[model samples]
Target: MRRRNRSTDRWRLADDAGSAAIEFIFAGLILLVPVVYLVVALGQIQGQALGVEAGARHIARTVAAASGTADADARADAVLDTVVEEYGLDRSRVELSIACAETAASCPAAGATLTVTVRTAVSLPLVPPVLGLDRLAVVPVEASAVQKVSRFWRDG
Candidate 1:
């Protein structure tokens, strides 16, 4: 009877020996998944923000340097497209707005202040497209840049 009791005690201890490892794994997973998702979501938002900022800054410069309205529009479009592609931004989601401080009936007029704004909404990773949840889960990012048109600009 004593031997049997000892055997039961050993069995109970053995049963608990590997439980720490199991608990560790379970706890690690519970904490790791959310953290990893947060990192990925933040990365997406940051990348989009950088892309928008670059687009705005480059487009402002391009427009400010242009010779005329047509040239400015063309250059701005080109810069925006390049930045969108380079930054993996959704072209359909991007919005660009340009404003000038001078009201001489000419945007980006010589010595005028050019302000360019870029906007977009970033969607979280792994969001299911069901019930419009994917659309609802978005973070809006916007960036703006200002540049002064060259005073010696020519109207071509």
Candidate 2:
């Protein structure tokens, strides 16, 4: 005679109902991977922005130190390279654009300002490919750094 097996409490036991919860748990983890990747990408952008700004400040400081007659463009480029490297960016992907104001209204009354813009194309290796975001190819990341000339560099 088989005893009634109450040990298998059908109501409280795991059943088809729990299957959906299990699927949800797995799917949630899959979805969270992309979200976390995007957050990391944003952080990288922020870091690059700070690096560009620091480069600009360095350029401005260095240029202001030399005679106003010097060719600051080269020095500025070097400073930008160092800054990009410091920020852990690929030198090839990193692009820098600089502007030098020559007119009194633009550059006078204060030391020269160095505006350094750095941009790179960043791609999410694991997440984007799975989400069909690969069609976009690459996302452009941009940052700008501004540095003012020191008081000493100003023309009295």
Candidate 3:
């Protein structure tokens, strides 16, 4: 068999010139875009989770340490507001619930265990507002904290 000429083969290869670069860019975008978006979404979720957890814990502590039910309510509201602002959470979306371990008529009673729960949804970054996509593409985050009120606690 006769050997083929290298020059002819080189010309044939020219048809695919720059194909590797194009393929690389296409594949990289296809893979890297999702990865980058996942990272951003996870970061947002984690931040919101931490914020919720902090809010619950702090509110529980504040309520447990308050002098009376009215004081506890005020302190909890203040802490929740601060936490929402600091964490960039939507105040309108945030939900808070407070309960006590004991079946006492009044929550946060003296020597009772106070439980506080904070819940919210984290909207994914770059989500479009159209078609309610922003609302649908959200991760729910919830946190709860429990603290014991002082046995000597008294309401004024």
Candidate 4:
């Protein structure tokens, strides 16, 4: 009887030893998956932010280099279209606003400041529309740039 009880206790201890390892594996998986997902999401958003910043600078420079108001507007639109295509962003979701610190009807005036703003929203992956987190899941990114028209620029 004493030998049988000792053997039973040893088997029980062996079984319990493996339970901790199994639990540890499950806990690690549960923590790791969400962290990986968050990292991927953040990387994508950072890329979009960089694209927007570059686009704003390009648009401002393009407008400042134009010869006239009409030319500036056309060039700005073209640059914006290129940015949308290059960044793979939705046209309707992206908002562009331009403001001229000086005369609005002129392109290259001396000391004129051309400001360009780009705004877009990035939607997080695997975000469900429940728990009132839908709005929180969408991140808004904005970039602005200002360029001055050269003093040597001549209006046509």
Candidate 1 residues 64-129, lDDT tens each?
A: 888888888899999998999999999999999999877867677889899999999999999999
Model 2 scores a TM of 0.59
How far out, in Å, is residue 125 in model 2? Answer: 3.6
- Candidate 4 C-alpha lDDT tens digits along 1-156: 335688888888887787788999999999999999989999879878987898899988988777666777799899989988988776787888888788756544656887889999988878888996766888899999999976655666
lDDT of 2 by residue, 127-153 (tens): 456566774666677766566655454
**Candidate 4: Cα lDDT at 132:** 69
What order do candidates take by TM-score, descending?
A: 3, 1, 4, 2
lDDT values for all models: 0.91, 0.63, 0.93, 0.83
When sorted by lDDT, best at the front, the candidate numbers are: 3, 1, 4, 2
- TM-scores for all predictions: 0.88, 0.59, 0.89, 0.78
C-alpha RMSD values across all candidates: 3.5, 6.0, 1.9, 4.1
In Å, residue 89's CA in model 1 sits off its true spot by 0.5
Clashing residue pair totals per candidate (backbone < 3 A): 0, 1, 0, 0
lDDT of 1 at 155: 68
Clashing residue pairs in candidate 3, if any?
none
Candidate 1: pairs in clash: none
1-156 per-residue lDDT for model 3 (tens digits): 999999999999999999999999999999999999999889999999999999999999999999898898899999999999999999999999999989987887999998999999988899889999998998899999999997767776
Candidate 3 local lDDT, residue 107: 85
Cα error of candidate 4 at position 85, Å: 1.5
Task: Give residue 10's error in model 1 in angstroms.
Answer: 6.5
Model 4: per-residue Cα lDDT at residue 143:
99
